[model samples]
Target: MKNKIGILALLLLSQVCFSQLLTRKLIHGQVVNDSINVENVVVFNANSKTGTVTSSQGFFSINVRENDTLVFSGLQFKSKKYVYSDIKGIDLKIKLEIFTHQLSEVVVSNKNNIKPIQGSQSIVDKKYFDDEKSSSKNRTMMQVGGVENPMDFVRMYKDVFKILKKKYPKKTDFTTQTDFTEIVMKKIGYSFFTNKLKLNDDAIKLFLVYCENESKARMFSKSTTEFELMDFLIVKNMEFKKITAINK
Candidate 1:
């Protein structure tokens, strides 16, 4: 009877241990904000002493257990703390307020404005048309109405080209593939791909790369609204699932 009781006690202890292990799983979370860039925000788990920085899309995953405290801090945002109660779902959405700096009042004065010296005589140097003529002779062919000559016409065109180049320079797109992907992911969230679209992490990444191949995806970076981008993603996601045969 004592051996039987000991075996039952061991089983109960193992069950509790297993439950604790299940509670200590990786929790997916996001630092959500409309006005600020949520990337690089630090999320510190006080209990475990482990932390993770938010992605460009403001998403982060951290190992959390029951009753663990998560602290979120960033340069631009106010620090916030959240306790893991398991009351909320596995996915945590933390909204942080922007930190505003209070500035002291500044005063400007023009009280000591400079005044011209009293009774100062102004001197002027007189110049004749000879100086103007000498200066005119040093002027370039384009400035001297020499455009009628073929060589002068070439010089004139070169000058015009330089001006045009300065006025309207070629625009270079510094936006990289990673940057574009982040922008799309930020506008449309990770949950959209994971939950609604039923895409696994690897499949979601591949689907994004597939979408990036589309010409319309580049346009989504610019003036396209979130709704428009979501619509585009939905269509592409269907095509992606069809091609990859990813039912989930």
Candidate 2:
């Protein structure tokens, strides 16, 4: 009886040590919409060796091995990736972003001669950030434009283009943020256009990726890991620049 009790105590101690040991990590992040917390967004481990979804409170806890890569995915949102070393615990906030999808037609129209729109482009300004200011995790300022909702911007741009076409009634090449600014600037003799912008697969693909990153960052921020990501655009890089000036 004494031997059995001693063995049981050792087993219990071993279990406690295993749970407390940080051999693996618990990955977590909150999924919120507008200001309200959204629950039950699916989160999967990207490494494929292990994976799990979030809980009802927009939080998820997944056990990850050392050096494992984590991938968080959801509906109508971009998927985000992170490393095991980057996530500390299961307390973090994630903000999801939406994508825009528009189809332009190529047909003969007597009213106006608008060219067919082809290809998708994304312009990411190569930003140089200034000195960092110390702030709380929740107090950090997020650009309302990028974080608020991108779908609205897409609609507003589309409407403006429609108005411009109606007013000019010409086949002027329609250019906006939809095209690479570097390509446009190269034609216009501006070298600052060397900023990083690439033709993403499509708007949905881009938005999904953005949302995933944003959400992952939110959760990753709560972790003890340190990140070397670029600073927010609004901090020091927020400014309106022309993508292209259409010709009549």
Candidate 3:
């Protein structure tokens, strides 16, 4: 009995040491950008939920582990993510792309051929002015007429509601959160969870629940692209695997 107890204690000690070795460690990293202002750029480790900000020189340090996802976000730069794996050295260098805004095309045209009016004289035709005034008055009269009957107002409301419902279905109406999750699962396919992530059926369901609780994964159903959803799943998978290993 004494020998068996000693072996069990040794096994437990080894497991504890192994778990500690797998834990995250502080890593020094730098953000590379072409622009001069790199200050205050957020460097976040999604796995650990810890973050740091870059200095004026774009240097930052944060805790990270193998397969950890580091997200860089800032006002002036497009958001970027880096997975830490097979890194040889202690320092990491990540590059950021500057954000650019493209304005919609605007056309400046003198279609009316109307010059600036001199004193009381007008350059445009009097008939044109009269036509514009008559159209504006007609629109005002139509609005002022309003709905004649209470039933007519209700019918108009129902018609508008139907149009909105067809365009954008409410979550409580036809789809619940579970429905959204299932839709996403179908879109991504079962093979991805099993083949790429190496997750069993039960584990996949559990992982989805974990993501929903931790990262609000259901919110992705709103406006996320396939690429964006895949990126999120990849990062969440790394974190999920880390948590599972720790629990073991």
RMSD per model, one decimal = 14.6, 27.8, 17.9
lDDT of 1 by residue, 138-244 (tens): 44544565553244466578779999999999976545333557778677888888888899886676566556545676655544578887888888777655544
Better of 2 and 3 by TM-score: 3
Show where candidate 2 strays beyond 4 Å: 1-22, 35-39, 86-90, 102-248
Using TM-score as the measure, which candidate wins? 3
List model 3 lDDT by residue over 102-167, tens digit each.
889986886877567565334322334446655545545555555633355665787798999999
Off by over 4 Å in 3: 1-21, 104-248
Model 2: colliding residue pairs: 78-208, 78-212
Taking all chains together, the TM-score of candidate 3 against the true structure is 0.40
Best by lDDT: 1
In terms of lDDT, the poorest run of 10 residues in model 2 is: 239-248
lDDT of 2: 0.45
Error of 1 at 16 (Å): 3.6
The 0-to-1 C-alpha lDDT of every candidate, in the order given, reads: 0.71, 0.45, 0.69
- Mark the regions of model 1 whose C-alpha exceeds 4 Å error after superposition: 1-10, 17-23, 103-248
Candidate 2's residue-wise lDDT over 1-248, tens digit each?
Answer: 99999999999999988776546666555665664445434554555444444455666666666567766555555456666554454565666654447669665668665544454222231234544565423437655535532355765787799999899995544333223322222332222212332222342232233333433333323222221222321111121111000000
For every model shown, what is its TM-score relative to the native structure? 0.38, 0.30, 0.40
